[model samples]
Target: MRAIKDEHRAARHRRRRLSLAVGIPVAMAAAAGLTYGTAFGVFGEDAQPRASAATAAGAAAGAASAADDVADGMADDVADGFASVNALGQNGTYGGRDGKTVTVKTLADLEKYATAADPYVIVVAATITMDPKGKEIKVASDKTIVGSGTSGQIVGGGFFLGQGVHNVILRNLTIRDSYAGTWNDKEHDFDAVQMDGAHHVWIDHNDLRHMADGLIDSRKDTTYLTVSWNKLSDNNKTFGIGWTENTTADITIHHNWLRETEQRNPSTDNVAHAHLYNNYLQDVAGTDITSSYGNYSRGNTKMVLENSYFEGLNNPVTKDSSAAVVQRGNVFVGTSGRNESGGTAFDPKSFYAYTLDKAADVPAKVKAGTGPRAATGVTAEAASSTLTVAKDGSGRYRTVQAAVDAVPANNSSRVVVSIAPGTYRETVKIPANKPHVTLQGTGGSRKDTVIVYDNAAGTPKPDGSGTYGTSGSATVAAEADDFQARNLTLSNDFDEKANQNLAGHQAVALRTAADKAFLDGVIVEGDQDTLLLDTAAKDKLGRAYIRDSYVVGNTDFIFGRATAVVDRSVITLKKRWDGTSQGYVTAPSTPADRKGFLITNTTVTGDVSARSFYLGRNWHAGGDATLDPQTTVRDSALSGAIRTTPWSDMGGFPWKDDRFAEYKNTGAGSGTASGDRPQLTDAQARNQEIADWLGNWNPTALNPA
Candidate 1:
């Protein structure tokens, strides 16, 4: 019997490898262009492909038995992953399965049933768009929000699981298009789904995207949460975890397709046990958004990533200096930047039993199996014309700059340059002549596509023509009107530590100096003067809308002269290159008559020490006091890193003379109005709203209604 078992195991391995070799090309081809029907036929109905014939008759019989084992390994409706781990005396995440079933077609009906005390299975039966836009229906414990076949569509709003809520499930629904006019929506906390300190929840087989804020926000120590077989796309901040300092959250993320998103490809922060496997993260370049990173392990998180497929991501798998990440059996195609793993992560099998599909099969398997399954048949939208960029010869252009060069100098319509997942170490400049051009990332995740360079303000030109000034040191400079970048990273890895002797340390990751410019789901990083949001000229009116993106740096990081609104985004304040804790967040140099910068509905935080940083100091361009340098920080969360006196003087200019004020701000950094800390009154805040600054130009009109 032992001999027979050994023969069967060997036979199964050989057959699987053979099937992979023969079927992978077909799968890849199908993923590229085929419709849902054709893609589904390539794999048949089986979750795992059938094995080839064995050498002998006895071995053939054993191989047949092993095939049965493969079928049994696939997860079923009865909870799997971390949701299956019994905790708090509960068996698993059943989610009102045995409770009374109810059907709802309107917001009132859905809200009524969702907040009820009794357990109920709620079925959404129609396309219901929330009236108040971005409204979140508070859901109680022991509930299920499932779509009625393929008819259920929840638009412009979503559900909220509050603290201690448990035993809930959100499945088989299409929740999308909640985008308000402001990309950096600082006023609305809209999300497809959000849980605060919730547990025993499962989010599976749903399509979520284009929300005003995040697609999914699992914050405040949410544990016993399992996200599986879902499609998250067309947005910034796909999925986030852990807002609490305690590392108590346990999560399982698997078999999901995260595409066209910017960052937080499930950023697991301070998680005790984070088990991710068999997920497909594709960053489709040449779209409106690019991804920054995927599977980020932050704040002492212990993460285990396995058998996943990552395409065209900037940083596919990354961890903070204090985090532990263990990766295995993952396939990275066209990926670039940091694919790091360190420390021994916990064994996922000890907590729950789950099977992983082969990494090579993940893309096909996930695309075919995930998302809402219609009762009739699966369907997909047709592809649009796009210029492809891939370094591996799979795309039309070999380099990103080449694709940009191919675009018509003065194109009338939008020209999308889709970049495949890979590291592109070059500076990209979008000339002013090229308008309505989008630099998109076509990868499984945004982190799969990277556009990076290493040039500091002091770096000498190759032609020996002096230094590349702060304005010229940008990795990606967009000087065209209506320019957009999605789902990618623009990084200036200038090695500030290595070039400490250099006089000028400013390194610009991204500089946008055009009107109606937009950046979605992108990562712009450097050491000093990272994101420079300037106008076409000092007198030109340049309005840049940056949402669902990340800006990382220290001294005068987010400084510029443009009318910029950073909504629903994160401003990460890192220490100086020498590892010093002191720094400033912004150094606005706006013209006296125009608005400098509006950091609203955003979060200001990082790994820096408390009371070490200032909110901002006015920047008078060329010592010109005529510039008002106005900056309003409102309705945002500020970390303790900000000093008590968040404003300061600069270049012989008193910050009090400039326009710097805050309103309704929270966290340790926020304080009452004083001489140094200016606060906006309710009457004053009304004048400083997003609408007041963006007068006559509605940013929301750019997106689909």
Candidate 2:
């Protein structure tokens, strides 16, 4: 039996090789079982055929058995790869380290432990503060540097992975304010964390931010490096995949949250191959994932970009004439540019046997699965008890508003409020003093847990703040930081059918001015400015992440100045009762230097007629028409109800100069033949991702699940 299995495996390997050489897709080859070992398995040892017909039937049966074995083997290989998502190429990604543990609390101890050649597990006991002018600390081989909870940190200085460094794992620590000796001089300085000629490295779950120069730079023959579950931000030059000319690097970067970083979110210059998957890039200002090495006329850089989310990014991915980029199942929302200039090609299937996620599923999956347990705040919440609320007066509070009011002011940690299914008609507000609050629905879905109110933009407030402006008319308003809601619905039923032109005609369902606000499986429904996402403070920026939710409205339904990402959600356009024409989808009043909105992996469908709805219109709220109104709709499907002139003018401001773009969208409404829709070049789209907008804030890390 052993010999039979070995023989069949060898035969299948040969068949697979042949099939690959002929350029067949691996999926197809797997389906056919590589046409190997089919005949040998069916015939039993004692069985003998009496006639030619019987012998032929026996042979056919054996072929089928062998094919089944081959298919099973392929399935096994796929399963193995899935289980080893963070492993480094058949080797343990966690570097060589003995079970012996060592505690390092100060800069002196850190240097001593990190450079020692002995294998040891180093636990950082406290934050190590260093001066910016200090020398860099170099880490040696065969060691693990982990933090004790969120207390461990390395501040003001940085670390280095120099030559001969191998088998290292660094995780669960925060590194900040690592300024280069001098600014803006790449030749004279190094990144906050530099990897030069290192091998078998794993860097995960570290919070790195506010560096003067590049955040993380890997160059000079670095191989088998994995950077995952890290929060990187506030650096002008972010991550570099390769810096040395003509040097090849083997690297895989996944599930990293890069926020507010200007450029080089891992720019791959002359690298051999990079596997970048499941990353969230938000509010990134400059070009993202650039592959241009034309200055040196270098070799091709093959990149596999998959299962990533880009929000408020200027450029998403670059596919120049020389580089090879394989993009599959990526979500780009509210981002302006996507690979309009497509030249190079590569296949991700050739290197591995894995399944590609649907673009719509990427946002939710990445949010739930990406990053460390600490960053997501998932582990502690699950292990602790939670508070509950019911609208029917069964337990705790009788209304959602009352429950929200019960939360203590200025809370730092997450306080989850689980609300039972009911429609509470009262207005609700999360005050600015209260932060880190999660309002979760205990029902089956967002529809079952409802919060409704009837108030238009012109409605009078009890406090006499005059009529509620478009920003003030929300039924449910969140005005704090780290606000989160799941499986709930917020609606404003102001009878838009009766008040079209009257009262300014803006009824907001949900208003969020919270920084790091997150919503999962929620709903916001209304007409004319249904969702208001903005910042309360003028000095700071607000960010919101909405995933796997549903939104319905008309006339700038989802409008705001905040850096917002809507992923895997549906935006439905409601038909006007008067039946003249539908209004626009978005009206963004973003700040000049900040990116605006992203709608990715979503679908637009509604009650309107064919060619009735517009996508967006520019809102010159800040009195700057020269500023680019950053709004992107990409990797989404649109219904025929959407018009060919997808963008419109607002208050005499034509949207031609606004940064509005569609990238490889499919559906009845996304036709480019009329030349009205603006498209982004491939090079420009390369830099767009969720990491660009929400710098150093891991939107996925906030998920409770």
Candidate 3:
């Protein structure tokens, strides 16, 4: 039997005892009411050994001195932070598939399909540069215009959704430098993408910038629309919804990165109900978002702001007396902004069945899924930017694996491998010799370029190992040093629903066992063990710089011994389809010396019920491993899926001995320190900075100019 420890060990037992004596009954009854199933161990007895009398008394004294009185507004803060809003509107069925396939390359070919009556999948083969500046192409109904490869652009022009235009899907295209004549010497006309009296439209994974007028304007009774994963930047007027009409406009703007723009990002005019969630707004000269300027004579507008991040902006939300704004789960950093409406605003809950999120955790959620990516080469010139992978043989290679195999061994300079907008179902790996390699996707965002595999930890491999271990089931594995990836999705679609009871169902989406790596605008999805940052070199170990990314999973999703810094990222815990008990988030097995996981300025979202998931636990593999797990989560937003007991024991390792701490965390899941969570002091938090953890390696220097 393992011997019981002292100091913090006794405190852990005390809290466990208190929780069992108090919180179990309530949680069990709540669980039953929620029909979440059993095996949650809410009332399980302590299986480990007990402490001595002296140790217990010392632990009690420590708890008394460390824990302060609970402040007021705790319940209100939880309510404000844990609310859920619909970003995709009432139903997930925004654009159902009922279209015929048709590929188009030039402007004439595109125009032919745009005016066609039947529903068509118009795939753009190359960049269509318009000689006539600001010429707008009118798109007809029932059209899906998707960029086929890296060369898809509408330079000096834009798209126009005229009257009666509906059910149009525009994705993975660039609309830039659109100058539709000049007015008052200010260059007026030309919206990057304009919609007039259109409905049921989906605009996703598109880059719209440098327009004379608004980047996008949906007005004149446009309803039932979803705009996601688009980057709007370097423009005067960003966007405006329901600008002209007093009619009810139902619009959802989520996962959009609005940067370096002026006002109207966007200004909501006569919108009936607008849901703005998980969006990143930065460096705006004017108003960020507004439900104000309302047609007060028409009716009151309702805007729900949830899980949004605002930085370097002023006057975030300005509401009219006739409009109502419910501000929840939003973060304002390094800027002066009004979160709540100054004038009369309607209740968001009254308009829809939704919950709120904590204002503090919004930054993490917003940056995780926002903006256009992998367009760095398209926007600027780079020597390393070359190579393309297209499924229809439009580019150099068709499969991502073939592109990796083509990389010369022991390459010195960085090589950018551009992937087209398509789903490649294959496992990919970068050998150790291939360094300074960048795998990029020309999809505007992660939703466009998808690389997937169906391998779980329980799945058998041809190798001697009976099953693919947790590390072996990854869809994309980068084993080389100085590896980088951006604007793409790596997913492991193992059927966890069918094999719920099977052991080792851990399906890893991305396994970065590299000495150094950087990930930006990336999406990694799986059910369990989604992201594995394994320690690579013995001297350097694994050091990763992950920013502006999204990771989704359930049990031990972000597990590894790597010293990783995850900044401005979104970590989402998806609820199991079978409705079983949700599992842990992080399982770090860091050694005694190294820094394990430092998740800062990130958002941790989930679909599970309140207080259902543990933040992290010390992973022991199989036996009592001497793994001193070190992790710190600060300045981030967490969903209600995290429980009050944020830290818990894993196997025989006591969580009290680990160096897991959080500071300045704002969200529903950020409970008081009296519970399982331990608050870090100012000095202790200073030791957890990126510079402090990474000795000489600077992540900011890695950014390509």
| Ranking 1 against 2 by lDDT, winner | 1
Q: Residues 503-617, candidate 2: write the lDDT tens digits.
A: 6778899999968888766778887898888888644699987776677787888887899877666676776657665788898877766778888666676656678788888
- The residue ranges of model 2 lying beyond 4 angstroms of the native Cα positions read 1-385, 463-465, 498-502, 579-581, 673-675, 702-705
Clashes within 3 Å, all models in order = 44, 52, 16
- Estimated TM-score for each candidate: 0.47, 0.45, 0.46
Off by over 4 Å in 1: 1-385, 701-705
Q: What digit string (tens of lDDT, one per residue) describes model 1 on residues 96-156?
A: 5444567798989999989999876687888998888888899999787788668889999
lDDT of 3 at 638: 65
What's the TM for model 1? 0.47
Best-to-worst ranking by lDDT: 1, 3, 2
Give lDDT per model, in order: 0.76, 0.64, 0.65
Model 3 is weakest, by summed lDDT over 10 consecutive residues, at 73-82
Q: For this target, which candidate reaches the highest lDDT against the unseen true structure?
A: 1
| Candidate 3: stretches off by over 4 Å | 1-385, 462-465, 500-502, 537-540, 622-624, 702-705
